[model samples]
Target chain A: MLTQRQVRLAWLLVLPTLLVVVLVAGYPLAQVFYWSLFRADIAFVEPPEFLGFKNYLYLLQDPDFRQALWNTVKFTVFSVSLETLLGLAIALVIHSNFKGRGLVRTAILIPWAIPTVVSAKMWQWMLHDVYGVINILGVKLGILSQKVAFLARPELVLPAIIAVDVWKTTPFMALLLLAGLQLIPEELYEAASIDGATRWQQFWTITLPLLTPALVVALIFRTLDALRVFDVIFVMSGVNPATRTLAVYNRQTLIDFQDLGYGSAISVAILVLIFLFVVAYMRTLGREALR
Target chain B: MRTWLRLGNRLLFYLLVVFVVVYSVFPFYWAVISSFKPSDALFASDPNFLPLPFTLDHYKNVFLQANFGRNLLNSVVVAGGATLLSLVLGVLAAYALGRLPFPPRNAVLYLVLAMTMFPQISVLGGLFMLLRQAGLFNTHMGLILSYLLFTLPFTVWVLVGYFKGLPRELEEAAYVDGATPLQTLVRIMLPLTGPGLVTTGLLAFIAAWNEYLFALTFTVGDKVKTVPPAIASFGGATPFEIPWGSIMAASVVVTVPLVVLVLIFQQRIVAGLTAGAVKG
Candidate 1:
């Protein structure tokens, strides 16, 4: 029920944002699609020659691209699952009546507030083979026979990166889940307790089901972020190949190797994968909500 | 038996709380302590939890030798400029979406959200080219423009939510008083959404400040580098040396302000984040 004048004013108001978005995001996105179809190398003294689908064809055979895709999937699955489980536990604990609850919440947010690169740098020093406190801690706790090169070892590097991601992002997940936990009416829990439900039963039947919406939202956000993770891997293990996610690999290809066409192909592939994930996730969540 | 079970549960809860606190706070604590330790003490055989005989050498090195001061200034300008630009554009768009019954409102909202989720790397190649063409590459303006890709969408989404929640009666009354939509927005709505503006603005500032990939890609020289890249590329006298103490000092310098702001606005930040995320 709006007048034409109001509608025109609305369009006028939204014009600036729309223009900025188009200039900054929309135009570049179209450019990415255009660039992906060529053989362009900025470092090479030659112009871009269109090679429709050739760049993507090469990507199909690129072992590094495959490995990066695998690494990204592995990182996303492991980190998001671990973060969710740990976040749930922490959220449940903090949701309860406790002394210093507010203080604990603020403390946990410190890690999230710290820039990712700084956290990665801090962990790099803490994981140093010789001078690291983690090694010293391991030895004292009887967990290790000697200092282990956590970031250098191929088997341990990805896990080490995952551990750092878990530490930095678990609090964010907990915060989101805690918000969801608060929305569950207290009377529901009270009624369950009055009906002779055990604590564990109440949790399984009440908390898990009621927290699904937040859980789904948090999972999607974390998964999307984890898929394109760059800062942690870049700062911690640059071009290591062992822990290179798609975003890091894409940067290496574009900036380091100057392979513009190939890099754009990778970027487009990532966008496609993420879009599909989001669509499928929203669809399933929509169905669940309907049920 | 019931009393015993209750006691055990209480003990476990306390232990879990302690673990959460220690895990979250200890890294920053250790970083601060390490920043104050002398080079020799840092590599000592025994790791000290506390900085015994604290030294300011690392801080001095960071400021005097490492060129971190310039980098900090760059981060402030880029992040601050981006925040201001996005807030202005976002408020107008959000006001439109929230107040006016515009056609395609949902489509516009979804478009903005989709832009936020798009992988930043996807745009790096194109954005780099665009910036170069516009003669903005390696400039603060380039980074600011690139950052709008994230900040604008986020600001619009959060502020839209805020504006929707504001009382409609105020705008109607203003309308009856012969106030235009723009006038109502500026004269009436802006005053009411003060807290929302602060929350959204702070979150946008934080995002731009912490941004890494674009800053790393867009800027090259020490003149234009931000804290993340500067800290990442920090080195010692030798190629093999890492200069951990100085790096920790720079980290402390870059992080302490953000931690203080986050602590002060913890409640509002949480509100804005959840409003943008969970509600959507």
Candidate 2:
């Protein structure tokens, strides 16, 4: 179907993107993998010595790394599940006819648009032990007996972080699901109604099955992001061992401690975990799509 | 009885809408009002939701004392430069992938998507060494190049979808007139995909502006630092005091422009974000 000139032209056009990707993404990934096999601490005068598998072995025994791995899993599971449910509800509500639908849609996007660091800082203020509006309101409304330090308490920090993640990203999930919701033919719903299907029955039978693709995409994206979450956790908690995710721990190891080998090992671990998640996600979705 | 049930459902639906709007809007709204309060008023025992007798001192402190104005300029230059570069490269590649009958096109597209999934920290150590060797460390160029990691993938992915959606008949007509492929793209397709360009460009700019980890790791000097790091490193006049007011003010300054853009291009943004995901 194609001529020789078109193939040549296509290659010509795609060359630059390929080159940039190679220089930036490809080379660095290889370098990270290579670096992970050595003991490369920059603070010492010695050059990096090869210690194949030792760095990864050290990480398996490292308490901080294990804690970080656990924290990342907890964060991803809690935040993604909550966001999916809340986002589905929101998308359903916004899909219906309303007078100020445009305004509501635009308003909801503001949270998503704001930079994560800024939102974290804003929430930091609101979660302050003293003078925080959240504490003020909680006390007044009898939700708490007195002011509680939301981010400072070890028991509460992870939940607090999840709440913020849910707040910022539920809109994005909703937007994606809303697009899927809109794609369903109106006739299907009308047909269901004529068959005396209840509202909940129509939702279960027609809406959910059709929305599965979008749900998969949204879940994968959010889960991946949650796994590597750095900005909010770093800014809000600052290397607090309790709240550190894998990405933040990797940064601290590489940058602060100048432990290149250990950091790259952590990086590789994170990548492997994410890869497994993506593979599982694709397999399930592929099977479901065929069905 | 049926009417009552319908009325109850409507009330619950309206209540859910109200909750969504308020939950989304309140934090930013609170940040804006808090930015206007004086430091003393902000720290008052009873928090004032409204900024009574609002002051601009915090804004003044951000611009004058914290030297945030320079950081704001740095953000604009870096984010703007990255977006423009990615857009140029992305359009060319997207045109090929979307229009040309190239073998392995799906593979190439998926490869780009895979690049986006690589956690940034995994690349940081190698990139730091490479950039330093290239004499780009702590430079805007380094940050810009690194930004390609995210921006290029997103731009190409979105634009490919946009290009695919264009009518094939238009390109065929141009070819019949003896126009070259390049000529058709420039003279015809470019004008038609204006909205796509805006959507992709805005998203790229926002991503680059909001990037924190790379900017924090790569750049060290105050002169090169972007707004996120600048705000992160901001300190009170005294070491013992935290400048919440000035910090809030700077947060407002950095966020307002993005909020304005989102409001203006709400529909386009939603379309661009969902296009690739839903289609895939």
Residue A136 of candidate 2: its Cα lDDT? 90
The lDDT of each candidate is 0.92, 0.89
* Model 1 pairs in collision: none
- Candidate 1 lDDT, tens digit per residue, A1-291? 347988998999899999989999889889889889999985546888999999999999999999999999999999999999999998998899989999899998998999999999999999999889999899889999999999999999999999999999999899999999999999999999999999899999999999998898898889999999999999999989899999999999999999889989998999999999988988988458524
List TM-scores for all candidates, in order. 0.98, 0.97
Cα lDDT, model 2, residue B26: 95
Off by over 4 Å in 1: none
Candidate 2: tens digits of C-alpha lDDT, residues B1-280: 9999989988988888899899999999999989999888998887777998699999998898877988999899999999999999999999999998789798999988888777888898889877888899889899899999989988898899889999999999998898888888889998998999999999999999999999999998777899998888778868978798999999999999999999889889998888756554
* CAPRI class assigned to model 1: high
- Candidate 1: DockQ? 0.85
How large a fraction of the reference contact set does each model reproduce? 0.79, 0.79
- Please report the TM-score between candidate 1 and the true structure: 0.98
Best by DockQ: 1
Cα deviation of A68 in candidate 2 (Å)?
Answer: 0.5
